[model samples]
Target: MPRRVLPLTDVQIRNAKPREKTYSLTDGHGLYIEIMPSGSKLWRMKFPQRGRGDNRLSFGAYPVVTLQEAREKRLATQRLLLQGIDPGRYRDDKKRLAAEKGSNTFEKVAREWHGNKVPTWSERTATNTLRRLELDIFPEIGRLPIHEVRHRDLIDALRKIESRGAHEVAHRIMAVCKQIFSYGIQIGLLERNIAADMKDVLKTVRPSHFAAIDTDELPDFLAALRRNESRMLKPTLICLRLMMLIFVRTSELIETPWSEIDLEKGEWVIPWQRMKRGKLTVNPDTTNHHVCLSRQALALLRELHAITGGGTYLFPNQRDHKKPLSNNAILKSLERMGYKGKMTGHGFRALAMTTIKERLGYRHEVIDRQLAHAPPDKLSSAYDRAQYLAERKVMMQAWADYLDSL
Candidate 1:
């Protein structure tokens, strides 16, 4: 026989007194109110589980939760149980989701993602990435809950940037936001990457290559460089000539630490960390890029060492010896020499590649290897770093001699 417990009334609950021990007043269907010895009242529920003893759940303290509200909670919990869901677990998940939503703001999650990526990025890249977010993005949707940020919200923010005529900047910011959204998904704070499909949404920006001059123009360019040398700083002049000799990227050249050089061996082994695509600071399988120094290059380095020998960087900033020269310094120097739109520091790479192939008759692969570019065949990307080492040494010296001949 089942026992029938009458439904509780507000008056009955108000008149109830606490006993020496806790006592429960049932309103049936597993819902009841417990009167504690301390005179505090709480609502509780008991439900049956198939292979286990009955489980109980708390509906919070009474007076805060009225009888009607407690009944509503009881009905909701009963529905979960009927669907084979555990009410306690459901409630816990609900609480966890609410806490996550409150804590994972877009800015907070983006900053966390940025921190996790700092190790893989150059110091300049890391700084510029965060600065772009702070200046352009955070002010727009920084405080929004990450999960709640929709596609339209992201487009609206990116559109605002595009409207400013900074199409490249807008594109870069959108890419960064997409990465952040993916990170949010990885961390369980977001469900979808809303910014994934926005690749062509912004204005179409024509790809621009670094300005380079044809090999025949090298003679005139050299003449201009010589005429402008008196107006250029001594270090800047040396940097320009070294750039033409080595033909490395401006960042790689300007940021060179003296320790990376081996004047005794006539080699400069740039560690993988300094390489643009370095995935790790210390990698065993991926050897560093070796620049074979020519007689011309060695002489210039000796001249540079006389000035900056005691410093850390080969091209230390004029005002701050401890810091490297600005990446823009070479560009500014070239612009001053009247080569603003025609040539760039990066243009030297193109110039060297073409002249060596045409004049010195070196294979493209050998020249590309010296240029520190991956092999064209995807499978051969991990080829030995010393592949064609002897040929590359000969090619580098020949290229330097060709440049001096001009």
Candidate 2:
């Protein structure tokens, strides 16, 4: 049998004085307030653990937690006990989950993901990726607990980017966020990737190729480029000419370190790490991309070297020579040359591929190897293992001679 303890009144609680030793005043059941010698009152509960024994839980302090709130909490804890749950353990688990959610914010997880992937990415790639997230995605939902973030929240964030007419950027940011969430799930910070299904909801970005001029447009394009040379920086002018001659990817051209170029040997050995899909080697013999610089290209390099020879990048940024030129530098220069919408920095690759194949009379395989096109089938894969060094060296010189003739 249990003794009948009367529920305490607010009046009695307020008037209660602390004794020499800490003491409790019960409000029936197991709910009570402990008064310390320092006159601080704390709410607490005592409950049986069925098979284990009794355990106590501190609800909170007096006035702040209040009498009514403590009763509600005691009832909740007792309810859990009746259902064979440990109130203290349940409370601890909830608190732990809350703390974890606070620490596992979207921004925190995203930064962690970025840090982990930075080693594998180039300096330019790493910088742009983090800057994109910081400017776009982080501003919207970066503070939200990743686990609490739903697909709708993500859609809302992406909608803001779409509102700005950055459809392609929106698509890219969504992909980055998907990878971020996937990484969260991988490390047990989240149970699911909230951003997985968001792609279908975003605006459909139509596939578009890099804008390039046909072979016949080369003369007019060259004339415009020469005319714009006075308005452009000397390095930019030289870079454009080299791009025309080499026709490598814009990134490959702009990010070229001087060490990669051997002017005397007339070769530019772009390391495998610098190339796109570089993991898939061009041939079994080597992974480094070897470019045979034609005499015209070498002359241009020597001329540019006299000006920017001491610096790292051949096409160092005009404002900051310590770094490579901005990715937009070439495109903006092309735009200045009055070829906006008609030609892109990337367009040179297409123009060269077309001209070299049609005009040079080179076989498909030979030109394709020069272009570093990924192997399509196992047969081509085997073909990829062939460096075609001797033929490629001759072909590259001919290509340059042909461009000079143009």
Report model 2's TM-score to 2 decimal places. 0.79
lDDT of 2 by residue, 276-296 (tens): 776432433335677767788
lDDT of model number 2: 0.84
The model with the greatest TM-score is 2
Q: How large an RMSD does model 1 have? A: 6.0
TM-score of each: 0.75, 0.79
Q: By lDDT, who's the top model here?
A: 1
Clashing pairs in 2: none
Count of clashing residue pairs in every prediction = 0, 0
Candidate 1 per-residue lDDT over residues 275-369, each given as its tens digit: 76564444322547888888999999988888887889999998888899996788898898888989988999998899888978999898888
Clashes of 2: 0
